[model samples]
Target: MVAIDANEVSKRYGTLQAVDRVDLTVEEGETFGFLGPNGAGKSTFINMLLDFVKPSHGSVSLFGNDCQGEGVAARSRIGVLPEGYSTFDRLTGRQHVEYAIRSKAADDDPIDVLDRVGIREAADRKASGYSKGMAQRLVLGMALVGEPDLLLLDEPTTGLDPNGAAEIREILREENERGATVFFSSHILEQVEAVCDRVAILQDGELVALDTIEGLRETMGGGTKLVITLDRLEDGTLETIWAVEGVDTAVATEESTVEITCTNDAKMDVIVALHEAGLDVLNFRTEEASLEDMFVEYTGAGR
Candidate 1:
């Protein structure tokens, strides 16, 4: 079964098209990433999926049930850590997880959920006294109740420290391994890159790019990094490499290595060119473009 299906989905407010005709499908058990800048309609799209915001046009279905028409049926086994989630001022961490357990009719231990999100020690503290990061963890713990079949997280790492973020990523990995379909939405490229099987990029409320990270890199001019280790280097060696047909940029990084950004087809040609120039090639490798590179090229965010 398709985990999520959004067909020509659109949401408009006044003169603004918050989401414009986005067509997307996420297969069951797939870890999918949804990325966009702030106000790129990511949250709006998510709201539509959860039936919290009605789509102005089109339809969305979850597990073969129309999200808006059959809200409870569509979302029964789904868990969500929504954007702008807040903790109740009086509820302790344990109480929040317990509430989710009760809501889901699950038998999960509250302390176990708190421990998984790395806040077991603070489980007894009132959420009002928790820091921003702690509150984020509390919500995530709530989302993990019932061993949900689908996890829809919006900016899951918001307000987390580096260690806390790492913990969340690890938890996501565990969730996916246990057969849950993870629909992760965040602007933190690295987090998405770490766990997502495929990613879709939205820009200005339109779907601009959708593919695996490597696939997106290929679309964006083969942003591959080629590093060549030579027996020695000379002043004109880099200039010679830059003159190659597919080499984009070449720089001497060390006494014996030249790192080049070039097309995928140029990697071997670069080594051949160096050998022809009386240089002994010792080692060479190519690294695919970073997710950040793809994000910048496609969305022009953080440019």
Candidate 2:
């Protein structure tokens, strides 16, 4: 089931086309990552989903209801942690959280929410005195006020330290385990890889790839970095590697090591081909391709 569906959404600013005709669907109870470079229209797409920016052309639905229909009843069912969010500096952390709970008509206690986000000890402190990471945590805690069914986070961990980031990730996991659908947008590919079940990558306001990590790798001409310890470099080795199907590039040095880049399901073939090339393979390690590599390959190559 799709928790959020965007059909052929397009947004334009003057002569600049921010979001092209893009289609996206986020499954219920899934942690979906929205990834893109700057100016790739991620923010525009998110704003449209929240009804903050009306799409130039297209439709948005949340839990099978039109996003723009009625008085944002659909929005009340979801939590949002926007990028560069700021709160009233004079309000104490506890007051901010209490206000958010009351505004959302939530039944949960604000103390529990503060503790869950690890900000309880400092709840009575003024927001003006909180550090960047602490302020971000308060914002996230505000979003958790009602335990909404869906969470829309934009760069949720932007100003956090490693420990804080880990804490936030753990909280997200716990929420997902409790059956909440999480739509998290971020440029940090490593964080996305760690937390998201599926990812959609956008480039220059265009959707380039959408799939599981493994699936994306397969579609981008799968790359494998081979660290081989050879007894000695042998002749015909380079020629033999190029002969392997899907082996797009190979560099072998006189130092008895070869690094290879290839496509889908080509590692085993590469190993066999290398052995066939008559080099005594002492140890071989293949580095799996990451989302960054796929991004570079597709966007950099102008695909």
Candidate 3:
């Protein structure tokens, strides 16, 4: 079953087109990541998915139910940790979790939820006194109430420290293992790369790329960077290496070393070509493009 579906989804706010026409589908039990720079319509698209904001054009569905027409039923089956969710100042963390449990009609123990998020020690503390990280954890625990079939987390690690972030990643993994589909949205490419089964990159309010991590690297022309150390460079060495099919770029970075960027399938060809050219293959190391590298290439944001 398709867990979430959006067809030509778009939203405009007066002069601003917050989300351009976009189509997306997430399969059941998949951990999907939504990525984009600020103002790229990620939050807007999420809002449309929750029916928090109406799209100017297009349609969305959750678990085969129309989001707009079946808003309550759709939401009832999902847990959401929205961007900048507000908490009642007077409510304790435990109270917050309990409230979510009650709202969902879920038979959940608030204490267990707090323990799962590693905030049990602060369970009795009023949200007004909670630190940003503690508050973030509290909300996350609330989202875990009843183990909903789907999770929509937007910037879930926003205020977490490194340890807290790691804990969240672990929780996401555990949740996925338990057969829940997770929709994660965040700017932290590393976190998304750590947990997502597949990712979609948004640019200028449109879907620019969508694939598995390695697939995205391939789509963006990101390949293995092979740096070879040589005893000495012979004349025409660079030309000879570049002539190898699938070798995108080859340049001498130093008198004794050359860097070649090429498809993974071409690494051996590059080595063979260099050897055939009478250059000793002293030593070679490869560096794979990280998700961040592909993210920058696709969104043009890191530049």
Candidate 4:
């Protein structure tokens, strides 16, 4: 069964359009990433999927159930670590997990769940005294209570240290292995790249790009980049570099460095051209575009 399906879904508030018409679908057991800049309507779209915010137009469904018309049934199949979730300050860590267990009618032990989230030692500590990271982990533990079919995590690593973030990644892998689909949205591009099978990039309330990392690189063209530091750059140096048959783009940096995007086969040609132009090659290296790189390219957020 499809884990999520949205057709021409959109949301508007007053004169602002938060999410434009967007069509998206995720397969069962898939690890999908949703990305967008601040105020780009990512959260609005997610809230629509949860039926927390009604759409201005179009429809969305969860596991074949219309989220708007059947909100409870749709929610039953998903576990969400929502953005800006509040923990009950009067409850202890264990109490929170136990509440979720009871709410889901699951037989999971609260202590076991707390231990799995690395908060076993603080199970009796009131949430009012928990650190931000601790509170984050508590909510994640609550989400894991019943082993729901879909895990919708929004900025799951927000306050985590490196070790804590790594632990979350491991937990996600474990859940996906156990047949749960993961719909992850985060600003941490590296973490998303580490686990997601495919990613969709949103901009200005529109779906701008959707593909696997490599597929995005291919679609963007010249996935390989060459950073060449030269002794000095003369006039038309960039144009000379761009003249190379396979080069897609060439730009001269402030420090006499030339950045070029070209096919892997064109790497050597760029260097030879610099030498032929009488510019001494100081240093050069090739790197494939990272998710962060593509995110910048797609969203125009880089400066």
Top candidate (lDDT):
4
Question: C-alpha displacement of 278 in model 4, angstroms?
Answer: 9.2
lDDT, candidate 3, residue 299? 77
For candidate 2, the TM-score is: 0.82
Residue 181 displacement in candidate 4 (angstroms): 0.3
Evaluate all candidate structures by whole-model CA lDDT and list the values in order. 0.88, 0.83, 0.88, 0.89
Q: Is candidate 3 or candidate 4 better by TM-score?
A: 4
Candidate 3 segments whose C-alpha is farther than 4 A from its true place: 226-285
Is candidate 2 or 4 superior in TM-score? 4
Clashing pairs in 2: none
What does candidate 2's lDDT look like per residue over 117-224, in tens digits? 888998899999998888989999998888889999999998898888989999999999989999999877888888889999888888888898888876757666
**Whole-model lDDT, model 3:** 0.88
Where model 4 places Cα greater than 4 Å from the true spot, the runs are: 230-280
Q: How many pairs in model 1 have backbone atoms within 3 A of each other, for residues 3 or more apart or on separate chains, i.e. clashes?
A: 0
* TM-score for each model: 0.81, 0.82, 0.82, 0.88
In model 4, which range of ten residues has the least summed lDDT? Answer: 294-303
TM-score of 1: 0.81
lDDT value, residue 161 of candidate 4: 98
> How well does candidate 3 match the true structure in TM-score terms?
0.82
Candidate with more favorable, higher lDDT: 2 or 3: 3
